[model samples]
Target: MRLKFQFGSFITFIGFILSSLIVTLDLEAQTHQFKLIDEETNRPIPDANFFYGNEQGISSESGDITINFQPTITLTISHLQYGKRSFTAEELDQALKKHQLALQPKSHNLQPVTFISIHPNAGEQEQMTLQVQDKLAHDAGQVLEQFSSISSIRKSGAYGFDPVLRGFKYDQINLVIDGSQCATAACPNRMDPASSQVPLNMIVEAEVMKGPYSLRYGNAFGGTINFKSADPSFTDKANLNGRMGTSFETNGEISRSEALLGITSKHADIKLFGSLSTGNDYTDGDGVKIPANFYRSNIGGKIGLKLNSTQTMSLQVSNNYGKDVDFPALPMDLRKDDTWLINLGHKAVFYRGALSSWSTTMYATKVDHLMDNADKELNPRMVDANTSAKTNNAGGRTELRFDFDDDWLYAGTDMRIENADGTRKRNMLMGPMAGKTLTDNVWQDARIRKNGLFAEYHSQGDNFHLVFSGRLELNHAEAQNPDAGFAANYTDMSSDIVSPALSIGGTRTVTDNFSIGLWLGSAQRSGSLAERYINYFPIGLDPYEMIGNPELKPETNNQADLIFNYKSDATDLNLNLFSSFLNNHISSEIRKDLSPKMATAPGVRQFVNVDKAKIMGFEASWKQIINRKIQQVAELAYTHGQNTTSDEALPEIPPMEFRYRLIGSFINKKLRTELNFRHAFEQNRIAKSYGETKTPAFNVLDIKASYLIVQNLNVAASLQNIFDEAYYEHLSRSVRNAESRPIYSPGRSFYFSLSYRF
Candidate 1:
């Protein structure tokens, strides 16, 4: 009896042990871990929010998180102002084993969330985007000029305004309207493009990305500007919104009026935006007439469809007509520029087990334009010398992202195609002989296509973070011209090019209030068709018709930057230093022996692979809240560049500048007022590459006042260039042999606006 009892006890003990082991295995399968890191610096972020099961969870003090999953588990990670991310059990396991997982921060705009997220800076160091309400409720140029990075603003003599960013001019910068590429053929002289299509009153917001970081938009060697129109907000309870405003400026003799109407439902939304502006020549600071006068009209429409919870599509079209646009810098002016643009895009998101989340978009655009000489000097001689040009572009980009738990990693690929065509006709009076007529036309009927693939990886630990990213791009270009005369002038060309880029950055946090970040990157750009095949008349730089250079090579640049940030509840300060080295910089230079009128003369201004160039700059900005009713934002920037081989100052470099803004609000924020001051140091180090023109320095002041009329209505007014100081941008191109040639900015202007929300 004793032996039998002992046997039964042993069997029971073994069974218990087996069951315990099986339960432990099941719990291990349900467990997961994650680490949160800063996007730019790749440093660990402590106390972030991590969610699993159906409820939100908290990260540990060391930026680490572990979760015991429930059945049908889903894991989500989120931080303040950063975009939220989530993953399924299968996706989490794959990401952890690969040791690569990352979540992108939210974009500046909250609506139409984007997957290609950039991290947010702490405190005042963060880049801020003006909301639609802010834009529609303020003066366009006045609001844009508030950013310290922008150095110059020129009213296009017509109704619109031209903004020169950093130092880049003309087509070197890319412009997008409603997320679609707007094509403009009006830049034959590199004067006006799609950026001029939208009046300030019609724009809901404009986002400018400085430097080569703009490659994602197009072949934007310098930068990219994106103009967004107001869309129906999902957060609004009502389905309709309407707004109207009017303003008059004394300096430019300008009168502007605009209106916007929008309708929204749960699934479908439509909007109509339009503006009308007219102005006459205005007097300068000294009461001298500047010959800056013109009239313009613009209209745009947008239609959007929300197909489902994760998919949306939109279509937009716009038209702009301008007459007698004048330019102080050029001898002959823009007589007429009629532009039209059409764009369409669709965005969607999908979730697939291990693949996680992905967002994709497809877009296309078309543009047409016509231009004529409008200067008083040319009108007396030529009567009419007009030119017309057109461009058509079609492209699409797709990006895929995968997130993991161990180390953050993201990868994507992009592709694009563009085509352009241009023509010019000359009508010369020739001493009343009914004017001799000459016509020249050029066509780029072929396609230029580009394909790129890229990947980025990030790792976050307790004290430090690291990131690595690389991209490879391939380009195929072909040009076809049907006009024999134009074809002979510009030889048919075809080429295949490849470019590669890499970036590495890291960050470390020494304490709770201080942190440092370092970044190094290299990028390359292939020449554009305009740079390689354009052979046309350049009105601004006379005694010379310009021709293209087919032998030009690609341009490359290497850059490094460092940033330090300090933060507190009431005050924030940031400092950054950066440097870049460019190789084979492609710039136009005159041929020494060519005569002034060889149809391609004034010495051929061909694009050449010039010597090396270097640029270095530093930027510092601070924001402080003096009290509950008062705050201040101040910024200072200095930049310098040189052409190493020529030992000459580089053309189109931003001068030293400073900006300050003071804000005061009262009556429980019902009333707000802001004061702005800006100063730019004289740019004496002028380059003689094109001409011996020197730009002077100046200072200006502005003020804005706003009053909330009701819960949905607001009234605001602004005064720009308050001091009416006379100034000219250093980068403005001058007409050859013109004594008074600098592009004069508007002297002083005042604007009043009213906004109403549904």
Candidate 2:
């Protein structure tokens, strides 16, 4: 076997030499000066990859690259957002002389952030730039709602939309901000999820990992959402910069304003930013007003010090506050929410020896939440209930990466501590208990601590790449209140979970334009605080109460994926097929039995462990340049899931969806217009035991246009749902009444935006 491996390596080296010689002979003395820019904006496209023969390098900040190669040699230029493009040496020379070498950007809606392993297959990583995100999502609240694979569950109209990815949501998915875990929601009903805390404008980029194939992030059973916030940029000398902008929307009379300021020096840098937004009740397509009023404000800053050329330390702090929020799906409204976050980090780099780099990070978060039914229209016999809660999260992580010949290893340790304490007070009005006040601890000082050690190994070969990772974690949780009405069913509330994570995948390049890849992985996720210890909490959007089971076991998933990619000068295609089998799956079961203390509850359910379950899905995307002035793109996604243990379909699974976009650029590519058509098939498969309902099919059309008025001034206009169709997503919540009709989406509205950079 060793001899055969050696022979294969020798043959590969020979083929490489022969290919280089053939290219060298084609052009004995040829030099190409290349300049890459955005086709639409004509701005420099930085950090783009360029390759010719065996020589490769990344484009500079100015998007300029000068290369000496054969006249017939092919040059490849690839980027995460722009897709991949190639040009011949002669074509490059002509473009350079004519000043027309620019990479055409793919429609942002169709791009997919994927994981692949080899040559032409692992060429690109998809992500949305800050500029694109800013244009699409006007407010921070709309950020996650724009993701293609994500569907928002709106307990409130537009305030807190929890993102569900591939039929998994909330604690089932891992949400990380700058490689660190944030605090969980303070509200028992999860009025505010983790993604709500990070303001949209503050994010520089967001990358979504579709499945558990990659485990660098912690306990990603369904997937991972990684958000990167804007940081201070380095400067040669002292410099100062800042920006301010404002916008208004017609549907809800929404108003928003934001500003950022930064000062940078050779050794130190500082940044400060803030935003404020307010909106009134939004009307539906039928002109019926929904009680969705909200107000939000946040302020944050960061300071960095350069200890040396290769070492740095930084400190960051942020605070967020919300007031007078209304939720139509629940019985209560949010009165106030105050949250604070702090992080301190250090990073260092080494140029020589086996050690490549190391980084350390520590972060803390605290949330104070208050809610009540004082502002809502309630029954005369109902009680006026008020709830207040506080949650704290703190953690630290340190990782070291080692590099050797053709191989790399990462070793790290991470720890997280979380605690929840809250209480609810009710006042009776006309009953025998009128004028009386009743108080109870909602969570009773519940505390959970998790510690983990992990390591990952990777290797590179001529035609195949390999990745493997493992992790061990310990979890302990307890609550102060042992009363029967509370979480008193604790027979040993501690579990030393030895969770193992592994992924093995590689790509085989069949040709320059085609590749095939396969990946297999196993991931495990322990139960969350709400799933394991909460006595009574409302599941967001769903009409059910959640009861905890302290003895519930962790969930494990073994998954497999296959990938196919095709890239050419005018076309890009990607398709993925994936499947997962889960063991000890945690799901909620409706309960009819009620104790004396719970007899008055509206809806009742308990968390339980299932023996087995399975899910399978596929995603496909295609992009083509129909002409020099037109582009066409299409994407399709669907997921099928089942609970074999209960012989039923999984609840809350999204239906089959597809999107088609037609983009046109004219006037020397300065002006752009887009017409998009979106469609969703009716969801007929649902778990009847969970009271899941079937939805009807719907189609919607949207039109948008943007133009650059001047060098620093830009304007954009959009007409959403041009026909004013009244429709609702499958995951939308129902009204908190006897009728329980699902909430409808917004009506047709005209939106316009303008901004100027100074």
Candidate 3:
């Protein structure tokens, strides 16, 4: 609740006249460090790890490190004794003018592409880099709604949202891309999620794996996300590159653009990309508006090959589209959506031994959805509903990784095939069913086929590091046509599930800088496709008309976690605590012998099997550098869900949140600035029989800057919410006649961007 200071001084004077119309005149360059050498004993090597897009930094034992240039600053170094590479910045700016830079010590240590196990192996790994240099993120749930612990599910006005970890969400989390889990959400109130169909400038990284540790990648009960994009490399001559960017904002005049291209040779590689975005309807620091409109687009391509030198292969394709999207708290309005994706992959490595690497991936997805209420507003028993949906998925995975002496083993096999069918139509257009016409079949051909087998084992020492994981699955669901009110209220819709999963975690060093970690897990999830063939369909959440419970029964998450850490040189910290204990907990119940077909529905609900439930959480993170021109980051999160056999509470839980950021690096780092703040605190443990609503606290502020208009171009600006905060975010959504109104955010905006790379 902060606004009107002349609307934050007219959005800080329109972000200072759009940063003086795209600023100019300021060219400084000071920040240093870019040294790492050891090409055959050239010395200085220590700790290594570098990256640009996903922004990582390390290298200090004398090997320097510090990067923030851009011109497509591609980095990606990594080194244990030299084992990864990718350079650019004009091949390291002449070794940063002799500031070192040299590496090449891989007689054959092969294995890259994270065939599996590389991230905390499964116990608490969080890597997010979806553009967050102080505000301006369009999708991927606005970059996990700003990291730490995470929560999102704002049912659109800005784009699908979704993502909710800790308390889990939809299919209990598992969003893969690049190892493709083929985009899955074709509206059923999910308005097309799959992290909003990629395209956040084609994401270059996103990783999270918090609870159910890992089981290769299947039945993840509540954690797993891996989104990576853009992988191109080559040398030995022959190259061509490209990139382009665009952005603009001022409360709903949103627009974005993207482009990229690549070509390499020495074996082969190719890439292409495209993007587009648009928005409108925004004005809410008490100035109303808020219908939230959208249009999106994306295109893609990829190719690679290098058949010798330890095998490799790749292929990719993509398509994403959306139009006129909007969901005023859900009731149809998304007029179109189309998604298509494909993936293929292969790799082999030998390093030396009985088995070292093997990987394979294949995928496919398709979605076509349409929704309508003819854009809301109009009613008097005047029917006009419409909905058309589609979803299809295909999957694959193959793995084998092994090494001994220090330990590592992994094996896998995966499969999936899903299909959901839909249709709905109505058209009364006037009184007493005037000129009636109705139809149904909201998913009458549901199907699910799965098969899995996984394994993992790892070990390390010098302090500790361990892992072990497992998975076993065989699910088969079928509705295969059943829509006559779902075969007269249920006749055993056929299911055959067998799930199992396990995980173990480790990390311990309790000294030389503190460290400790632990994890335990169990997972299972079944019952989807609308909990087993939705038929009455109102998609639950109070207006109630849902039904679908083909003998439901599979929901388990017996998790645990604990962690603590601390680092040096600038600062880095962590603290986590988590819990999950649920069993056969799939909610919804109430079917007073069914009787409520939409006249503003009020009875009828199905999909049961609720025995016990629980969820608990905590998170804290910090990063600091307070010296060379300030820097800091902070985070805190919370969760608490429950349903202890109906003692209630738990339906879109999300309340405690905190964030902070502050950065500045002027005249030497080529100018950079940031300040971010966020808070959320009021939310009365909702779920009042699921019409949940109690939000009230919020605070936001943002400011940004960027320069660098040379070394390949850059420009940025921001003012987002600088005191204009009408807020509402506690798992948003309300207003069916306004139940304490929610879903409001976006005011005092001004953002700008420009990018280029060679």
TM-score of each: 0.78, 0.83, 0.31
lDDT tens digits, residues 157-272, model 1? 33233455555545555666543355544455544545555445445446775555424445444556766554323312337765666666667667766676877776778878
Total backbone clashes of candidate 3, pairs 3 or more residues apart or in separate chains: 1
Q: Lowest-scoring 10 consecutive residues by lDDT in candidate 2?
A: 117-126
Worst 10 residues of 3 by lDDT: 120-129
Clashes of each: 8, 0, 1
Candidates ranked, most accurate by TM-score first: 2, 1, 3
Worst 10 residues of 1 by lDDT: 109-118
Best by lDDT: 3
List, residue by residue over 179-283, the lDDT tens digit for candidate 2. 775768888877777877765545655668767765665776888787765443455688886556566667877777777678889788897878777888877
Better of 2 and 3 by TM-score: 2
lDDT, each prediction: 0.57, 0.69, 0.71
